[model samples]
Target: MARIISLEDVLKDQIKEINQLEMVTSFIQNKEELKDSLIQAQNDIEDLSIGVLGLKKDLEKMKEHNVSQRKLMALYQQLDDRIIHMTNNFPESLTQQLDRQEEKLNPIIKEKTPNSYKKPLAIVTNSDLTKCEPIITGDSIVKDCRKMLFKDPEDSYIIKELSDSEFSKIPKYMIGRQTLSTVNAFITTINQIMKFKYGILALGKVGARKKGELNLYLEFKKEESDLKAANQEGEIYFFNADDYERETNSKLDKTKLNLLTVLRHCKRIHEIRLGKNVKYRVITS
Candidate 1:
């Protein structure tokens, strides 16, 4: 009989095949683990991008809120200024009444002052206003002063009629309630007599039961005519169309004449001259 192979050699051959197969299976398992890790990383990156976009939107909303808050703050400042101005010299009850009255009437009135105005260098004393006379028509002053003060065309009228001697006799001029100043220094100088007394530029019916009229007036002094032409005191001023528009913040359809018509007839003036003592100037805020 032939010689048989040893059992140890057969056993060694089978073990070698088994070890090779195990190595191949291990390699396949490691590759699958690496692939899973890569997929998880990609998902994390996508989630991070979504979170960043959400944060950007929230930042924009915050910015818009800040802007609105700033605007409201500005409005509050304006209201504060008005309150301070109103409280300056008024009694508490009177102030409250005035506030209520203004609230009720401001809307009904047109958004304009008178179309014309005069600027006084000084308030004429009631005693002196009686002897003094405004030789030139307030209308003329309004036109010239408008050019000198505003350097532009305007729509306005002067309350020239009130400057007449008859009106000066009224108690308003004697009181210090409604005196006004001019926009031009030169005009003030020329009309310095008006500076010594109180004058009214506006008057209207007032009171519910008594129905007495309300008047506005101011005190002026002739000696103070040396002040700058553009310096204004109270509501009265030497104004042109431009000055009226600027001071009152109003618009006019036409240059309203007939300002002097409101005055009682007096000796017709032959000529009027604005002396060099007064100087007209442009008004600036």
Candidate 2:
């Protein structure tokens, strides 16, 4: 028995079949693209995560190496001192042998130790740096002065003066612009919290300041709050020797926060408020 199929019904049926086929084809194509994209994105994210993990591991290693280097430097100094003392008490040949050993150890020490931590250092400016030598030690830490240069044989570093064009090169962490009251409040809070000695102040291009001359300062305080509480009435000023002793004796507990990292964070804040690099004269005072 042949079922009678009208032309209208046949046309409708064909149209429906074609539409369904088109939709299914489109879906299949989209699904393939989506799957490929998902796979690619997953791979990219995994690679980025691995890179971040590697960077973290490297940073940890660097920090450990820095600590070890500091200790090694102390040991080296002690050994040198002992050799000098023995020169007065022991034979000349023994002193010679010690000197030879020290010479042999120099390259290994330089290679293993960070160049930033060296000695006979100074922050020589263009005028002062006629014969520039790297400031390898803790010399600049004492002065906190500008026109500063530090030399380390391990790192070939240069600091340009703050001119209109070169000012950008000055680390963001090095520059601060803050109100005087705000600055004072911060200082008070820090002193109260940590009971550090006097703070060190240098002229940065910007900072929270009351006057023009009050632009820059660094805080040097005792590490232990208990000790600070004990010496509440006493003035807090540290000389180079005092700082050295405090550091060596483990009394000066300070962490050297990476200045660059802080600066990047501040820049983000500035961008949020000011919408990026609005070159305003940072009134330091």
Candidate 3:
């Protein structure tokens, strides 16, 4: 268009070229922004891959820890089973050894312990009489029997010779106050002789007294009379130190002869004190 193109046409052509150049510059800028977007997306994908690998490594470690725990549980179960088996099947020799050990320790333990055996009882028998002399002599039997009766004057018994019908025929009061005494005295005499011969102190003083002698006849005269009536006929047979000396036929000191001491050794007699006088009694039964 060197052949003198119109001015309007030239201006139009220049405007079209400027529009194309502006479009080209815009496309170049858009291409550079797209390249930067692609680089950022690649970096994000690489970081995601690294995080997945770390998660896989942690899962493997957890699996290994679970296996170790299972192994430990199995070991504990095996140990418990072994302990149960050992307890249930213990050897007999071990049990015998334990019993022997206990027996060995028993004597040592007993050495420090107190005696617990039962005390032997004193049993008097006919065999014992055969070995010992009679405590009461035949001469002293009557005196000893009288002493026993005086001590418990109120106690009286019916004669075995008298039948129940015969005893009943007599008045009850008369039987108790009159006839009973003679029967009692007779029975007591026989019993005393047997006790002396057998060497048995069955009715004698069982234990010692604190006082040598004490007033025993505390009953009134009327009471004594009633007791005498209940046990004896007519007058009561009262004995003293003189009577005992006469009966025993031993001239030993009368004061030294404590009736209680004699009663302790004797099988048939007891003593009571009435005012200043000493009375003796026989033990029946």
Tell me, by TM-score, which candidate is best: 3
Q: What is the lDDT of every predicted structure here?
A: 0.42, 0.43, 0.49
| lDDT by residue for model 2 (111-214), tens | 33222222445546666544444454655523333333554311221111123433345455454443334323432332232221122222222321322324
lDDT of 3 by residue, 173-248 (tens): 3344445344445345434433332221111122111121112222223334654655544433333454334445
Give stretches of model 3 more than 4 Å off: 1-28, 92-285
RMSD (Å) of each candidate, 1 decimal: 23.1, 25.3, 36.2
Model 3: how far is 67 from its true place, Å? 2.0
lDDT (Cα, 0-100) at 77 in candidate 2 = 100
What is the lDDT for 269 in model 1? 14
Instruction: Give me the runs in candidate 1 sitting further than 4 Å from their true place.
Output: 1-28, 89-285
Backbone clash pairs in model 1 (N, Cα, C under 3 Å; residues 3+ apart or in different chains), count: 40
When summed lDDT is taken over every stretch of 10 residues in candidate 1, the lowest stretch is 264-273
- TM-score on alpha carbons, each prediction: 0.24, 0.22, 0.24
Candidate 3, number of clashes: 9
